[model samples]
Target: MRDKLTTIGFDADDTLWHNERFFQLTQAYFAELLADHADHDHLMERLLAAEKRNIQHYGYGIKGFTLSMIETAIEVTEDRVPARVIRQLVEAGQEMLAHPIELLPHAREAIEAVAETHKVLLITKGDLIDQERKLAQSGLGELFDGVEIVSEKTAATYAEIFDQYGDGPDASMMIGNSMRSDVVAPIEAGCWGVHVPHGLVWEVEQAEVPTSNPRFRELKDLGDLSALIDQIS
Candidate 1:
């Protein structure tokens, strides 16, 4: 273990719990509904492209993604599109809105393990109400020493968080799923980062390749996290 360690920041959403799986299912449903008008793969491509183009307008979350699907379906099929598909989209949207919250496997165990020797902080971004609700449902709300719900995770955000919690970069580490927002941001801010990759990562959260660095490491899953943290320290 390191002689002087202070804090570790963790990402929420896919990192701490199951996320994006619902969006994948919703996309599958959307494809089925649009099968008569266009190929499933083509429809998905168009929808994804539209979402990317309108990211600044719609932001992230199920509501925006569903809206993009609906808008794209209308565009591809024209106004003659069947009511059944539209209705299905509406119902699917509602189901996604109501989807239950759940924790990722080994999330709490990882948090508890790290918290034993470091100040564990949660660094997540989303609609404040929605994020807070998820955290409440996670059943490990009390585990974090600090909680930051930002609009975006950037180098500046990581720097601010580290500055507020610890003296310098060496005293802190970031453990999360997204290399772009979680790992890269903190690393650029001068803190070390450990990536715990989830099976499903959102496209928007992807990062460019890293050449190599001793302060950055990737783990297969949360199960390998504690051991890596020990090794790093």
Candidate 2:
């Protein structure tokens, strides 16, 4: 088993560092900005709708989210959204882009421990520049054998990445907070999936847990990841 598992894939955002909370905070402010036009619930719903509609055109990350906020505001205000509000939205995204990286509990330790014996790769999806900025700021960049800033997480994506980095998807494991991308898709591609819950999650990333699958695992935090790998090996 030790020799069989040669590669480990880690998700960047919420799994290894503080990410979704910043988005949540910005969203709260977004709700406040358009408080006059719509209630909190309705505004969030509309913003989510805008995000869903805009994802294909804009892709994921702060810029896409900011644009969606602007679009939602325009819709709710019947195209009367103030220019000041749009300016603020853009500024909010700018702050998120420049924000310092904060590592999640045990993130670095887990990476260091795992990387000693297994190849470690960072697999994430977002705006290329913003993703690169965060990776640079994270200070963990030097540890990874490789980095893959993908456009999306799918079975084929995982298969290709694992094959490029190590033996193949069947000989690799993916650890992340999203059940859809981190667990289901990787497992579908014949890799092991480890889910480390981050509490705060984006709606689009949500998916049902694959409890029936033998390769699926749920960790309380990254603190125990090394022990789990040891057990598996």
TM-scores for candidates 1 onward, in order? 0.89, 0.98
Report per-prediction Cα RMSD to one decimal: 2.4, 1.2
Check candidate 2 and list the clashing pairs.
none
For model 1, give the 10-residue run with minimal summed lDDT. 1-10
| lDDT per model vs. reference | 0.81, 0.94
Tens digit per residue, CA lDDT, model 2, 55-110: 89999899999999999999999999999999999999899888999999999999
Q: What is the C-alpha lDDT profile of model 1 across 82-194, one tens digit per residue?
A: 77778888889778767678888888999999999888899888767777878888888999988998877878888898788766566788888888888888888778888
Q: What are the clash counts of all predictions, listed in order? A: 1, 0
- Clash tally for model 1: 1
Whose TM-score is greatest here?
A: 2
What would the TM-score be for candidate 1 when compared with the true structure?
Answer: 0.89
- In model 2, state the lDDT of residue 200: 95
